[model samples]
Target: MGEADRIITLPAKLATALHGIAPGLITDTLAFANRFLPDPGGIGEQQMDGKNSETYLSNSLLARLTDEAAEANNEIG
Candidate 1:
């Protein structure tokens, strides 16, 4: 999953933290997500282009820091 996807699936506490730091970011990510679509076909389904998002995220310092923190937390656990 991409950074946005990871953020979206975060626990409620983490989600709240993210919301406190950056208002509406989760909402924007959900808006771009392609799940729960009535029209799975080529009809009006707004899909977030994974390639573009991945590229953008790869260049994001915040994403890198978050990934490192998650890895460190996993190691501790």
Candidate 2:
């Protein structure tokens, strides 16, 4: 399994940490997570070319980080 595959399968906490660090590297290494990590919402059905794949992965990482930040805020507030 590739780094992207590992990230997708890992628990959210660990995944968040791994994703937060060296995201650019992950983006560079990605070979389309759709092959292994099927999006339950059917978002992965579309073909992911190189540029699209990078954007999608980056957006996904950002979304996960945002979610974690929101959760942290809730805990603190």
Models 1 onward score TM values of: 0.30, 0.25
Per-residue alpha-carbon lDDT of candidate 2 for residues 1-77, written as tens digits (9 for 90 to 100):
65555555457657567668978766655655545764444355665554334346556866677658768888424
Every model: Cα RMSD to truth: 13.3, 14.9
Model 1: residues with Cα > 4 Å off, grouped in runs:
1-10, 34-36, 39-77
Residue 51 deviation, candidate 2, in Å? 34
Measured with C-alpha atoms, the lDDT of residue 75 in candidate 1 is 47
Could you give candidate 1's per-residue lDDT for residues 1-77 as a string of tens digits? 64455454458658778877987888887777846543443434677664334544476885788668768888423
Clashes per prediction?
A: 0, 0
What count of clashes does model 2 give?
Answer: 0
